[model samples]
Target: MRQSACINTLIRRRDNASEPKITDSISPKEASPTLSRLGFLVALGFLRLTSVLPLRLLHWIGGGLGWLFAVIPNRSAATTRRNIAACFPALSSAEQESLARQSLKGMVCTGLEMGKAWILPIEGTLAQVTEVEGLAALQAAAKAGEGVILLAPHLGNWEIFGYFVCEGIASNFMYQPPKNPQMDALLRGVRAKSGIQLAPTNRKGVAILLGALQKGELVGVLPDQVPTDEGGVYADFFGESAFTMTLTSRLAQRGTPRVFCGFAQRLPKGKGFKVIVHEADAGIYDKDLGASAAAINRSVERCVRLAPEQYQWEYKRFRRQPDDSEFY
Candidate 1:
């Protein structure tokens, strides 16, 4: 568990309302004809049934699925291998294979956990958090009437982490809709029930985040994502050039909100999750955009190091390389 000093100096500069006055609201998308489709209905029912199972059972099932992923000739396993090999070249072939297998298993576990996240009662979901670390930064930001930017990377169970923040803090988050309209609606309905505002992952979302920060509200962002070409810059990630999102850095330039990186650690044997929060490295606030982006990557890297297998290696994070090389 790592922590950074309080950002009291930045918080002191705020001269605004005693509390954030957010005007924007996101209404959950209602059930439409699309959800009545057979596939969507079946999937919804299956997830609902899965939600009631004990965490340990769900994890056990996930482990079997992970075994299948590692043994089967699948795109996910292939991509995981490629990303892990590129990021950790020093690892021996045997080590890389082991990591890739474990990563696939973690991915399966994350999928199984989604049922608990979306279908369980808010109280029941929050109860799953056995411990929390570095919450004082959130408290200090609130006390000083300054906003907070919670940077939750794609490590451990990010969905759980988002819900945890919404339960405790007044937060707004940027979301990307899933390709399936039915699934997208389901997510919106489930997440909106917690009263956390969500905006599309676009310019409008950025504006909402800015407004939230200006009024001293908490804003959440997944800083490890790859932004569109116009919104990102090339930066060194794990000694390789990765196109990283700049929105976090741009918001950091605002110099008001206290930025923190957080994640939900999946405890072994399904004991529960532990929420860990840490202050962003100072370099993320640097005027140099590239340096700031690299610093952001470094912060995420540190979190990943805690549990490499829990990170989402299946994602094509290094897909858009600086030289346009097809790494995946």
Candidate 2:
């Protein structure tokens, strides 16, 4: 974790570095196919109205929405069922179906809760983190002036987790901007309110993240994302060869930054959330890129196991396979 003289100089420069603005990243030439300015405003207004509701009530509404997803024919429900079945083959058919239904419900709850995560005041939203586990690791890293690569999977309420983590450290999160300019602007404005810097998913963004790490700051990455062929390698995820991002592995190898995987687990009854953190598997730092990617998936699996139903099953995580076969 020791820093070189050059790194120290970069640390000093970071204090005065101007972060990339989200507005500047948007391309005016690109048009949003689904949403207009008026439509975006209406959606924003609805989200703002829902932001004031109690968390418990939001969960209740989400449960109803989830039930609808389970009973109705939809792509999300199908995907959830397929993922659960493939990942948990040991489970009986009945058990897998039950888990899929619950997962659908949890996914709906995640969507409804985003209003609180994005529209509510930062302090108010963080107040819902009733407990935190394994924070000492992150604190120790920060205290020793070491950069950290935090791998946050698509678990319960990741938006809330991002805000909570950035509150205590100079953190940067890499995000893919929405196609809709208006929506992207709104999301950027809310996320930046907590002082977390945003980096796009491009070369410049990668450089920004590298700079942050050199400065001994934390950078967050969604480890489960499916990267382009050149950016990732096929790795074992849930016993299947899934295309996984190697960005975390590459970043971890660059410096002595401690790599950790974490998530905010949603408690039952909309009680609150629990922030959990754990050091990543040792293989994450392997010199072999494929081995490193496998370790990244292993880390994500560990976090998902903490709350299986809360994991995002609707995503086609195993769509790309080693043999170029159709998975979903």
Candidate 3:
């Protein structure tokens, strides 16, 4: 099998460097579009306003907005309905609709919760986490100096989960940059507060992640997103054939790092979040690429099952089918 035919950049580093240079990736000169600048400012202002509100109030507003989303005829609601129907065939129509509504509500809450993550102090954010369920495994992995790959799915508030994990551990993760340069800068600034390395989703980013793993540091990936052609393979997710990223499997082949699945469970009425981590399926380490990808999907499914309603069902996960059929 061909290895990394899609990864495009080379990884480079100076001797004895702890962090890679990131400021050159996207500079202000490259993102001077007038419209994008306006949108970025508006977005930042909105986030600041939301950050001052209580968690309960934000969730209440999110619930109201979610109802509006479900009531209106839009692509997001339609996609959520189709995904729920395909994944949970056992549910009645009423049940599916209810689940779809709940999922939409959860997504809205997730957006508002980003205010707390981006604007609030690190201690303020950590204070909201009610508990961390699976710490012993991670601590053990760190002590062994074998590194760890944290497969964080799109369940609940992923930003909260990321912040919690990287707070204490020297971690690295790849993130797709936003279209607007200002927004991307703001995101990078907020996430940098924890002193973790953030790489843009590209060849350079993948290389950084690999380097971190080699150094016995934590690496995180959102294993649920649909990768581009040549970057993923079709895998059975919730009984449906979904395109799954092979990066997780490719990285696992490099070393004996422990792989764990994790997510932050949103508490009722925005009480806070609960972080849960568990061991990944053994099949993730299998030699077969397809099998490894499927195993990664199964790991994600297990995490989403912890709080199904919070999964980002609105995403077009099944958009690229194996037989070239359009799902969304």
Candidate 4:
């Protein structure tokens, strides 16, 4: 009853709020043709340069950049601190600060390493995964001809995880295109190189995901992203009310697919990454949308706890509060 009431209140607040609905479908900002082309060329050049450097060098550089972010007065740093403090209230202020710094470092490190994941040969990228913790579960589901819905949260290097899964299974990954058309095209080409189908985050995309699941193929969703008000519900995340997406729950209930949560943990000293997969919280399969949304958050929390410092704490995960108050 409490959960139901809370959700109802949240829904009412959202309905009455004046803010425009947030979505990923906004068109790219208008830019001059020449400038857009130049920008794309520069971005492509940077990717090519970074993709060739050793991972150790990239991490070393990223660490310095991340330290700057922690020390400087910036939105990312402030947001990271706020998120860490809220999610881990038991930690001392000093400890929270330290974790915030480390989290920034990890986040930057992952960004710098994206070249390796997206530009390098798929075989080479796969080799960087030194170990995989749970492959049998996925294999078992595939063997049984059951559809699998893998939830990869914003923990660790998710891009690497996507590549690894696409290579290992017949997979369809749901993604929202960037506002930059050139970047979107580049990323779409890079990701589809591994034989994985890319599903846009729209009605067509959802249909694509459903079709893939129905065919007993694997589908991946970034479960931590905030959906528009119409597509989400309020749920408790780390003891705070968070606007959680209902898509995962709807998919689970509608398709009856076997759900799993996983992430790629960046190993220390630039060694490599560890792909860890596990079953999602049992409540994710519950019929109640509120219970299922809460379960989605719980599953993400479980993954984040494995590598708290590596989680993407910089994102404003709790921006939509239950009382319609500002959180960031």
Candidate 5:
């Protein structure tokens, strides 16, 4: 009880004292609501119900509800549908719709697995790494002793991607602060326990990442996330000028040899997932910022295709636009 009080006091102090940074000006007041709190509650309820009935049965129930949501034509869903349609014009309407539904089901399953990640062992969690397609390239990079960067985008099981590295490569990952300090602490505890050292997504975190690279350790990052006003440049992503994070291109350009990408694809029939690691097409760094950003978007799209269901399309990805003059 006393320990809890001390921790709470520390959290309150930190919350009130957090300062803004040049890259991301997210203040304590502007932090998004933590999904972990609600996830925990949902997990708690799931456990209680599962204790009486079969776990598989409840999962099916969640899956069914997930599928139902897949078909709903709300505004946001429509926007996502339209975005996918424009991006992958090759796909027919029925195929795009199918992908959308599959993506929603993947999100629901991902939601249910949140609590599991908190408690599951790296061995069990990584059972989903079905195939390491081009692991030789990653292994080659790791052996070079110059520190490699593993770009894990939101396209698939991003959470699982970090764990795979920590368990298999003993690498470090960067994550931002959660809005709710309590929830952040809970997840930080889980991530640390899983063997991946977690760094804040602020200036200090950048230093830590650099130091890790210097020590010949891999640094995993999700570059598709929106960059802060000052930290990123507005680049065309999927035909929309989204503020793209220039960090990925910069690192790879600065001689982080052996940059590779990977994601955990959600599988069918309520089964497990598949992990796909591939070499990003070489053109993502073609001289100009605009070209490099386009390359980054293309690379993201390729990975997103492997497991479209796990991609979180619900995010306001294209929320902000750059003024006539752009800054990256």
Candidate 6:
């Protein structure tokens, strides 16, 4: 009887409160943008700090973050755990737990190293690339005087992949400019520091890419990013149909550009990053879009296999899907 009475009183209160109000407590347009700018400044400051800090110090901080995330019972983390679980089910519970721990550590370390990756010398970072194979293959592909397309997956220190191409291969790339204008200038400056031009992800950006191709240049891009709903097609990613950006395929089909698969595998400890390179697999340029996508994904798979620990396993890879599926 007491519970029923409480419920009735709550319902009455909610009904009365349904009427809206107009007050200063609601609008925050001016403050919102200002706060965002403040966040950008803080984020850049931290990036700068992390770049100079010793790798050991970053790992110590990263370990604490990993431990905290490992214990959390949450959505994004849990979903990533599930995806990883599917990839290596043969492991014991303890092994899976270790991977989860490492995933967080890898993520934190990457975050810590972003500033160095963006601004550090290419000669310094690419030293970790122990070996370079298939230079002749790359040269052969470029013989047609067409622009080369380099696709980096989420398998490694992707930041350095752009740097390697820009410095080693003389490539340029299109970038999604940061939403915050303050950071936009910073990113544009760093990404282009090696003399590679950064194209915007807009109509003009496509024109820039095509023009580069016509002039026999190289273009690098990360093909694993989620696309706008209107433009994406469902592609199989690690045994799941993920909404992958079709930009890679569309570009290859458009210009028949030679596509080389590359990724910067993050090394153990603070040893820096490595760039793994491979020729696109067969069927990547097939008339069948599905075949092409699968071939491209297979190429990415090879990059991932080069160093599984460095892969970005914690990313919201399968967040979007067709229909209303809660399996994620």
TM-score of each: 0.87, 0.88, 0.89, 0.89, 0.76, 0.81
In model 3, what is the error at residue 235, expressed in angstroms? 0.8
Clashing pairs in 2: none
Give the Cα-based TM-score of candidate 5 against the true structure. 0.76
Name the lDDT value of residue 16 in candidate 3: 17
Off by over 4 Å in 5: 1-59, 71-76, 284-287, 322-328
- Cα RMSD (Å) between model 4 and the true structure? 9.0
Task: Indicate the worst ten consecutive residues by lDDT in candidate 4.
Answer: 1-10
lDDT of 3 by residue, 110-187 (tens): 887777877888887777788789968886887677889988888888887888877778888887765446766877
**Residue 246, candidate 4: how far off, in angstroms?**
0.7
| Model 4 error, position 64 (Å) | 0.6
Deviation of model 1 at 109, angstroms: 0.6
Candidate 6 lDDT, 52-144, residue by residue in tens = 777667777877876676788765358658768877778888887788777766666666666566545656544435445554566666665
Q: What lDDT score belongs to each candidate, Candidate 1 first?
A: 0.77, 0.81, 0.80, 0.80, 0.62, 0.66
Query: Which has the higher TM-score value, candidate number 4 or candidate number 6?
Result: 4
Candidate 6: residue pairs that collide: 157-264
Off by over 4 Å in 1: 1-36
Tens-place lDDT per residue, model 5, 1-328, is: 0011112333454444433452156543344333334444444454334334432443576578666666666543565665667566788999988877766665555555543445465566676555556666776667777677787887655676667655656577777654555556666776776778777778888878777777777788776787777666677666677778777666666655556777766555545556677877576556666566667777787887666666777555676666544221
- Lowest lDDT sum, 10 consecutive residues, model 5, at 1-10
The runs of at least 3 residues in candidate 3 whose Cα sits more than 4 Å from the true structure, single-residue gaps closed, are 1-32
Local error of candidate 1 at residue 158 (angstroms)? 0.5
Better of 3 and 6 by lDDT: 3
Cα-based RMSD of candidate 3: 9.3
Error of 2 at 161 (Å): 0.6
Give the per-residue lDDT digits (tens) of candidate 2, residues 1-328. Answer: 1111111222334323333452256453422232245456665675787688888898898788789999999888899999999999999999999999889888877777777777888998898799899978887896677999988888888888878876878888887765446767877888778888889889999999999999999999988878887999988988888898888888998889999989899998778999999999999999999999999999999999889999989889998888788877
Off by over 4 Å in 6: 1-29, 74-76, 119-144
What is the alpha-carbon RMSD of candidate 1 to the true structure? Answer: 12.1
